[model samples]
Target: MTIDALRHSPEQLRARIAAELERARNRSTGLTDAVDGDDLVRQHSPLMSPLVWDYAHIGSQEELWLVRDVGGREPVRPDIDNIYDAFQTKRADRPSLPMLNPDEARVYVSTVRDKALDVLEHTPLEGRRLVEAGFAFGMIVQHEQQHVETMLATHQLRQGPAVLDAPAPPPGAPAAETEVYVPGGMFLMGTDLDPWALDNERPAHAVGVEPYWIDTDPVTNAQYAQFIADGGYADRRWWTPEGWAHRSNAELTAPQFWHDDGTRTRFGHVEPIPPDEPVQHVCWYEADAYARWAGKRLPTEAEWEMAARYDPESGRSLRYPWGDEDPTDEHANLGGRYLQPAPVGAFPKGTSPLGVRGLVGDVWEWTSSDFTPYPGFAMFPYPEYSEVFFGPDYKILRGGSWAADPAAVRATFRNWDYPIRRQIFSGFRCARDV
Candidate 1:
């Protein structure tokens, strides 16, 4: 049964929504203060919008979904809706749009949030998709949190001194050298009942996966460094034709945010890479080439899920690697607690039933799967969320990153990006034929 099946009371749902929104607001505010106004509006990279745009966009979406859709109220500022519509404008063009300035963005979001909470107080927890078990509220919280993560990425890409700070993660236990074996079987994948689950993650279905050997932990910086040291980027034989073209055109020598001189940047802070940490900011092309260099392959989304959520003895899947309990610091390094990836295997409590480590909350692991829908998939709330993004044009990334909100991190959560983009905190582990 899904968590929503528990029949949360309207009050309970209100509290949950309030708490999640507060967390998201706090994170966004923190990110906003990390840089000056110029940084907030400047497009740090072509891949993402300026920080101020994200700030206003968060409010715009919340207003669109919660204040207007759920509450049946007129928009607070309908004129700005198209301006903040992510689909209407490209990232490069967003800065030039009439986006609300940082101060106006903050005020707008705060005003909308207060009005949304008032609506939440009167709305039933069940009914339409927007209100059912507080799904729309949950969706808004997730959306805002997602923007916080994106803004954090922008901060990482910004050229400046360190602005964000967090305590370093404690060292991890040594991971077992042997690959974890996922026995071949038909395992149920995706979520049929997770009320907050997106359209792409619906209608759990059986997937027949062959037995395979997967790395016990994510590939580390040291391991990837070895690939680079061996001239992996220069070797075309290891790369797919498209991957080589991307690499050749971009002249990428290392993961994004890394220089040829053996140092990496995190949250705008430059330093030598922690060799044991899981590699971050790697594009699918780079990850695929590294897998080829190591005589392994990026795990298919099925294989990755099978390793992460399937329990052979129970013949059932779990809500997370460590079961249905909500994630904690001991389970994973998430919610921007450390602003950087923990060392691989740091969260032993987060291990999957198959003994795979760091399966969630470190860095998003690239899977060799296109962003496609399941057999019975149907768009809910809106088509723009996931339906439009489905196809071969995007690659899937499973497992949330360190900046990911706990509420947003789930065994079936799906994140997608273009194969050539690398600014996000993305990494990969390898799987091989048993």
Candidate 2:
């Protein structure tokens, strides 16, 4: 939908935002607050805001926009320009700022809430739409969601949750080749807003693709073993010139974590050799090699999204393959509480309507598309958000890793990394034509 139809009157916006703000405040929100009345100097995390910072930051945001811009009141804190701009922050040198104290911060958020409500009570209701107000308020909530995870990530080195774990490999199953299905069709891609999507996702255009088959899941260790055994790495014929050059330069023969059977897995114990656990830590070169050795190819972001929609059992868009609920301990290998990859086909209930499972939570799936914005992408006002990574090289990955915050694993959240280096967490699925 267009932005014009989305904007709301100031009063209606306030009431809608108030409900969301309360919901977020009640939740742990990824940012833990100090015990009430405790005299600790640091009331909240600088990595995440303290209780005061979050409340004030959110409130200041309302004040800047609603009171000052919309309602025309002078700003309570004109310095908001220093902290809030999402796009600008990324481009500057403020990553180390010791921000506002808890008390002052909360005052800001609370003040905004109070003033926002007061203004809304007298606002006109005739032409205001909840949709626009919802989107705006939702943006604020989503911004909070980001901090919630950021706070978790910054604390990962401390008492934060451990990395995600996978299920043990199936016993005695020979390593299998993976494939990608090439769906040749005029598929609808990108959101069409005049200022709707980020710059890259925009130019809302359609691409004609050829139909093909892709692997249902990412290539696992069992599959990689066969590639090595079949001399996939030793031969240069299977590699592209650039791919071969990279391989030679790195002096690499096998996947990054490949050692003699008992390596410490992302899961708790040493591997007795779980072959079905999706192979982790391989770079784009390795994934491409595996695809080449198997006579298939990697799917583009569009293709990957389309295949992710495939459900052999049902025909609907489910939030997760397991269904529309947030992941639980028994669902896909998430929260890293398991500490490693699960065997393929482990979560039956998590399968999508088309029988495609693990699309939402698992090792992030790499796609052929470079990490670029969609049509109509508007930078989130944070300079470092989108412009820093528009180069042609960075690859796009979907889904969230086991250790990634569950909130980060939404169907649309994209991840990217360079092609030559494979971290312990990266992996991929393949695609081919029928």
Query: Quick one: best TM-score, which candidate?
Result: 1
**TM-score, cand. 2 vs. native:** 0.61
Model 2, which residues run further than 4 Å from truth? 1-183, 190-207, 265-273, 310-331
Candidate 1 lDDT over 122-216, as tens digits, reads: 88877576677788888888898898889888888788778788898979777757488888789999987787887788989999999899999
Whole-structure CA lDDT of model 1 = 0.88
lDDT of 2: 0.56
Superposed by TM-score, candidate 2 places the C-alpha of residue 124 at a distance from the truth, in angstroms, of 13
Q: How many steric clashes between backbone atoms does each model show?
A: 0, 71
Off by over 4 Å in 1: 1-5
**TM-score, per-candidate, Cα-based:** 0.98, 0.61
User: On residues 1-434, what C-alpha lDDT tens digit does candidate 2 reach at each position?
Assistant: 12333355555455545665555544332244523323112322333333333445556666765566445676777876576554445413333445556566666666766665555555443343322334334444544544443333332313223332335422222223334333356544543432222334344456555677767666777788898889888789778788889989998777664665545333223345567777776788778888888887777887776555433345333344555455665566664444456677666555545345556555777777898777556665444646688778888887666655443354445677788856436678887757
The lDDT for every candidate, in the order shown, is 0.88, 0.56
RMSD of each: 1.4, 7.5
